[model samples]
Target: MRDAFVRALLREMARDERIVLVTGDLGFGVLRPVKEQFPDRLLNAGIAEQSMVGLAAGLAATGRKVVVYSIGNFPTLRPLEQIRNDCAYHGADVKIVCVGGGFVYGSLGMSHHATEDMAVLRAIPGVTCFTPGDPAETEAVVPAMFQTPGTCYLRLGRGNEPHAHEEPVPDWRFPKAIRLREGRDIALLSAGGILVELKRAAEKLAEAGVSAEVVSFPCLKPLDREAVLSLAGRFTDLITVEEHTILGGFGGAVCEVIAEAGCPCRVHRLGLKDEFSAVVGNQAYLRHLYGIDGEAIAEKAMALINEKRTDAGRNP
Candidate 1:
């Protein structure tokens, strides 16, 4: 996903000379091509995330489309104040790009985990949040973020994430949920790179005779309310999966819409249960430990379906 973001960013930079990239002293290998092509446009802030954001905001104020690049919490949590005050407050065209959204840096430990980025960034007013689920979604989202007029937060996975969309999402618009597969039993809605696991879970559910619909939400803040409501009306069960905490993250966002609309759909959120990760290894290991992997998602979906069946039998 990081590679796809850079590729898309490169294309955008070529078209618009006003675009400048500021990094927090990382991503040298991945961003090398960017530095080589646009030598004058890239700047390194030497691990000072706050200054990086402030610089980006200043650049944006000077009529430059500035993108602050970093990994995990450095770009979001570390310099959140600068983002809120300097960028969002002034409606600066600053694109804050985070390379590792969830446990992409799990091996480094909990400090690097971006478990609450979506929720944190979404709370700030006038900040657009983009949590692309795969390289394809990342590719589609980068241009939209640049085209957007105000401050935007882009949460991306590390490189080599499996593509969820079979074909290019050429028609994808900002803040709209894309339905990857159609089903009837339940709907599996995912935000971020976990869409790959959701897709696998859908297949597993299908094998067990539970038809599951898969939807990817690339933009989280201005969530696709129409799509969420449509799914709520169509399906009795809606499961929201994210790599972040369930409390105020993707699941919380979905629940907010459903509850306010008085929708009868039962939402089962699959994510971190309001706690930080205690153990760490690789991304896959942590996902399994937290019970947000493909197998766990499949099992949870089946349990939800069975519970509904049991309830209907008892009522009838």
Candidate 2:
């Protein structure tokens, strides 16, 4: 996903010379192409995330489209004040990009985990949040963020994420939900890197005679309400999956839309249960431990389907 973001960013930089990239003294290998092609446009802020964001905001004020890049919490959480005050307040064209969201940096321990990024960034007014599920979605989101005229937050995974969409998304628009598979039983909505797990879960459910629809929400804030309402009308059970905490993240966002509309669809959120990850390992290992992996998602979906069946039998 990181590679895809850079590739898209490179294309955008070539098309528009107003774009500038500022890094927090990291992502050297993955961002090599950008440095080589546009050396004058790339600046390293030397690990000072707050100053880096402030600098980017200043550049944006001076008619430059500035993008601040870093891994984990450095870009978002560490310099949130600067993002809120300097960038969003002034409506600066600053795109804050955070790589290694969720447990992508699990081996480094809890400090690097970006579990609450979406929720936190979404709460700030005038800040657009993009949580692309795969490389394809990442490719689609980069250009949209640059085209947007205010502060934006982009949450990305570490490199090597499997593509959920086989081909490039056509007629892609901001905050629109992309339905990858059509099904009747339930709708499996996912944000961020967890879409791969939900896609696998849907396949597993299909083998078990349970059909599951897979939808990827590349943009979290300004969620596709029309799509959510349409799914609610068709399916009785809706599950939201995300790599971040369930509290005020993807799951919370979906629930807000459903409840306000008085939709009867039951939403079961699958994510971190309002707690930090205490264990450290690879991304897969931590997902399994937190019960947000493919196998777990499949099991939960089956249980929900059966529960509904039993309830209908008793009521009838």
Candidate 3:
């Protein structure tokens, strides 16, 4: 996914001379091509995250489109004040790109985990939050952020993530939830690289005689409310899954939509609880530990399905 993001970013930079790539001395392996092609446009901020963001804001103020890239909390939580004040408050055309969201850096411990970035960034006014599900979604999101005229946040996974979309999305735009599969028993929604696990859970649910619909949410802020409401009205059970904490994350966004519309679906949010990760493990293991893994998703869906059955039996 990081490879695809860099490729798309390089493509955007090629045409737009105003676009600049600034980093906190990270992503050397993935950003090598970017540095080679646009030698003058790239800036190595050298681990100074706050200054890197502030510099991007100043550059954007001078009519340059800036993209600040770093892993996890380095470009976000570390430089939040600059982002909220310089970028978001000013409505600067600065794209804050974060790689290794959620537990992608779990082995490095909670400090490297970007579990709160989406909520933190989204809280700022005028900042767009994007969490792409796959390489194709990443490709779609970069161009959209470039065209958008204010601060934007791009939350990315590690790399080598399988393509979730079976085919290309035609005329895709930001803040629109993409429906991957359709079913009536329950609806499953996911964001970022977590979509893969949701898809797996959908298959598992199918084997267990439960039909599930899958939707991928790439854009969290300015969420596709109509899409969310459409599914909520159609399905009795709607479950939102994400790599970040359930509070104020993708699930929170979906719940807001459902609540506003008064949709009939009973919503279940699956994500990390309100605590730091204590165990050191890989991404998959961490997700399971939080009970937000693929099988966990299936279990949550089955519980909801059983509840509906029990209610019907009692009423009948």
Candidate 4:
């Protein structure tokens, strides 16, 4: 995913000379190729996330397409006040690119975990949030951020991430959800790194003769109301998965839609609990510990389906 991010940025840089990449001195392996490709356009701000955001805002004020890149919590949580006041408040044309969202740096502890980033940033007006499912989607979405105006937050994970796209890359559009599978029984909605986990769970459910539809939401801020309603109307059950806490994450956004529209479906949310995670092994192990893995997800989905089935029988 990191390589794809670099490649996508390089492609955008080749086309747009106005694009400038700013970092906080942590993207050594990821930004090396970007620095080599666009020497004059890349800047390392050295451990100052607030200053980096301010600098990016200043650069954007000059009509330059600015991208501030750093680890997730550092970029999104640490400099949040600066981002909210400098970028989102002023409506800067700055793209905030965050790597290692959610539990990507799990072994590094909860301070590095970016569980509340989406919910926090989404609350800000005019700020766009995107979580690419895989390398191909990351490659497509990173470059498209340049075209969007105002503040755009692109959440990326660590290297060697899974590949969700089996075929060619789809069209790039921020604040939109992509339908990966179609089914009437259930709808599995996911965003960020959780999409990969949900995909595996869907595969296992398929093997158990369960037809589950999956929706990969690259964009979470705008919350695709049309898509949510359409899927909710078709499917009898809906499950939302994310790497963030159950509070105010992707599932919360979907629940808002269901309530407002009076849509009928049993929604099950899969994510971290309200408590902060302990210092664990790594991202993968931490996810499993929290019951966010494929097996756990499969179990939850199957249980929900059976519960719905029994309820219907009792009512009938």
Candidate 5:
């Protein structure tokens, strides 16, 4: 996904001279090409996250498309107030790209973990959040961020996630959710960097002779209510999964939609409980400890489907 972002940024730079990239003393190896191609456009703000964000807002005010990049919390959490007041409030055309979302930083410790980024950004008015499912979606959404004129947050994972898109979906815009499978029994909605696991869970459910549809939710805020409602109408049971805490994450957004639309489907929100992640070895271990792995997700989804079927039979 990092490679895809660099590739897309290079392409966007060649096409538009006004496109600028700024990093808060990070991404030296990852953003080298962008620096070489557009030397004046790229700036390393030297560990000053707050100033880096302010710089982007200033550049945007002067008619330059600016993107501020850094690892996890420093970019989003540290300069959060500046991001909210300076960027979102003014509706600045600055794109904030965060790398290593959720527990991807793992042993680097919880301070670097970006579990609260989604909920934080979602609270800021006029900020658009984009959490792509894979490299293909990453390639698609990154370039679109340049064209979009507002404060946008891009949640990028550290490595390969499930290949949600069969091919390079460059023309694809970020939607509230994309239905990858079709079934009347249940619908599973997923968010953030771990979508590959969600798809695997869907396939496992299929092998068990249960029909499950997977809806990839790349965009969290300004959710596509119509698409969610349409899926809810078809599937009698709804489940939402994410790598972040269930509070104010993807599941929270889905709950809001279900309440507003008043969808009659039984809903289940599966994710991290309201708690801080422990100091674990890596992302995989941490996910297992938290019970958010692919196998765990599949198991919970399967159980819900079976329970719903039994209830239906009893009532009939």
Candidate 6:
């Protein structure tokens, strides 16, 4: 997925000399091609995330397209003040990119986890938040980031995630949700890197005689509210899945939309609870422990389907 980000970014940089890539001493190997091809446009900001962001903001203010890169929470959390003040407040065109979201760096511990970044960044006004589901979405987001006019957050997953979309998304300039699989019983909505697992869960739901619709929310902020409202009319249950905490995260974003629409649909928010990981070994193990994995998602979907059936039988 990181490769997809760099590849698209490289293409954009080749055409636009105004673009600059700044890293906080990370992505050396993965971003090698970019560095080799455009040495002057690329910068290593050492280990200072805050300074790197401040510099990016300054560059953007001068009519330059600045893309700041780092891993885990370094890009978002470490320089949050810079993002909120210099970038977002001014609507500067600084694209803050973070790799290894969630527990992708589980062995490295909680310091490397990025479970709360979505909620934190989205709270800041004038910033666009994007969590591309796979290589395709990552590619689409790159060009979109270049075209967008304000502060942006691009949350990237660990490399080698499964492809969720069949082709490049249609909307490169606007923010919206993309529908994957169609069904009537339930709709499984996912944001960020979790779409891969969410797709697998839809398959499990199919085998269990439950039809599940899958929607990928690559754009977190300014969520595809219209899509959610339309889906509410078709499905009884809307289950939101994300790697972040349920509070003010992807799930919370959907809940807000549903609440305002005053729809009769029930939304089940599936994610790492409002707590940190109890134990960690790897991304897979940690996701399983949190019950946000594919199997767990499938199980939760089934429970919702069955419960709705029981209610129908009693009411009828």
- The parts of candidate 2 lying over 4 Å away from their true place are none
lDDT of 6 by residue, 60-172 (tens): 98999999999999999989999999999988899999999888898888888899999999999999999888888889878877888889999999888778877777665
What lDDT does candidate 5 reach at residue 268?
A: 81
lDDT of 4 by residue, 1-316 (tens): 7778888889999999999999989888778888788899999888988999998999999989898988868988889988899998989988988888889988888888889988888888989887888787788777667777899999887788878777646675666788787765678898886777878888999998888888988878787888889888898778898888989988999999998999877678889889898757788898888888878888888998898789989999
lDDT of 6: 0.89
Residue-level lDDT tens digits of model 5 in 1-316: 7777788889988998988888988886889888777788888889999989988898889988788999978889899998998899989989899888888888888787788888888889999888877788788777767777799999888855457668776566656466677876677887777777777777888888877788777777777788888887887778887778888888888888888888887778877787887666688888777767778788988788778779989998
Span of ten consecutive residues with least summed lDDT in model 3: 166-175
How close to the true structure is residue 58 of candidate 6, measured as C-alpha lDDT?
Answer: 93
RMSD of each predicted structure: 0.8, 0.8, 1.1, 1.3, 1.5, 1.2
Candidate 1: stretches off by over 4 Å: none
TM-score for candidate 1, residues paired by index: 0.98
**TM-score for candidate 3:** 0.97
Q: What is the alpha-carbon lDDT for the whole of candidate 4?
A: 0.85
Give the alpha-carbon lDDT of every model.
0.93, 0.93, 0.89, 0.85, 0.81, 0.89
Identify the superior model by lDDT, candidate 5 or candidate 6.
Answer: 6
Q: After aligning candidate 5 to the native by TM-score, how far in Å is the CA of 314 from where it should be?
A: 2.8
| Cα misplacement distance, residue 95 of candidate 2 (Å) | 0.2
Taking all chains together, each candidate's TM-score versus the true structure is 0.98, 0.99, 0.97, 0.96, 0.95, 0.97
Q: How well is each residue in 1-316 modelled by candidate 1, as lDDT tens digits?
A: 9999999999999999999999999997999999999999999999889888998999999999999999999999999999999999999999999989989999999998999999999999999999899999999988899888999999999998788988878978888999999999999999999999999999999999999999999999899999999999999989999999998999999999999999998999999997889786999999998988989999999999999899999999
Residue pairs with backbone atoms closer than 3 Å in model 1 (clashes): none
